[model samples]
Target: MAHRSASGSDRSPHPGRSLAGQLQHLDALRRAMARRHSLNPADMRLLWLLSDDRARTFREISEELNLEQSTVNRQVNSAARANLVQISDDQPARLVLATKEGIAAFDQDVDRSLNGYRQALERMGTEHTAEFNALLAEFIEAYRDIVQPDEEP
Candidate 1:
């Protein structure tokens, strides 16, 4: 049986179609987050990594963030210029640490992001939200197994 979507288009029951729709929705959510939040995803991830206040070398950050060394260097340079983070001059390996401004910015962004999630969860209800969370985790693990199989077991 064929079902019509909101725009009067046929919604197929094929698994591929369903998966594609879900992926599209996820991408849209990512875009929305980037638009609404002050920081882009790359910057946000870097900041969160440094949020622990533990200084890490450029190579360590590049590996941790799964970003190229050049990209990491550029971001670190940008952040340093913004005064959001600091780079140490400790000999051979300089470490990057989040400054007070960086922490404050991250905290504010977290609150905003949390509130968005909170509102959505409230509308989804406790049971549905829990189920969604479980499925999302499972989906991520399954996808990772397919792509990042060479990494961690």
Candidate 2:
């Protein structure tokens, strides 16, 4: 059944649109944070995983991130070109390791991101930050309950 807003405009799918808008806002925030940092978050994520100086095979990274092997290879190649990581010389594992440069980049990105997050939390105030945290947790749980059943193994 179609529903009308206060202005009598039909808007049955409004809730769906609102949910999509929230997701879009999250994406925009990520992009903005990326821009404010030395490395984009996507690249930073890979560097973060390897920050312990542990070399991992592409398959390991792919499985860990639930990404395809080819996609992981592409990301690794990009990072290598930027001198952020190194691919092992033809070996069974063909392990990928983060460079010292990569570690520095990751540290910079984390610093910038944390500064932004801290300022945002300060603006939200203690009570509001706590309330928002609880509400966000509840939303995630509710949304997961609604969506997880259809997900594949």
Best by lDDT: 1
Q: Residue 53 lDDT in model 2?
A: 85
Per-residue alpha-carbon lDDT of candidate 1 for residues 44-126, written as tens digits (9 for 90 to 100)? 88899999889999999999998899999999999899888899997599999999988898888888888888999999999
User: What Cα-based lDDT does every candidate model obtain?
Assistant: 0.88, 0.87
Cand. 2 Cα-lDDT? 0.87
Q: By TM-score, who's the top model here?
A: 1
Candidate 2, pairs of clashing residues: none
Native-to-model Cα distance after best TM-score fit, residue 64 in candidate 1, in Å: 1.2
- Backbone clashes, each candidate: 0, 0
* Candidate 2 residue-wise lDDT at 65: 76
Per-residue CA lDDT of candidate 2, range 31-143, in tens? 88888787865588799899988899999999887789898999999999999999997888899999999999899889888888789999999999999889989988878
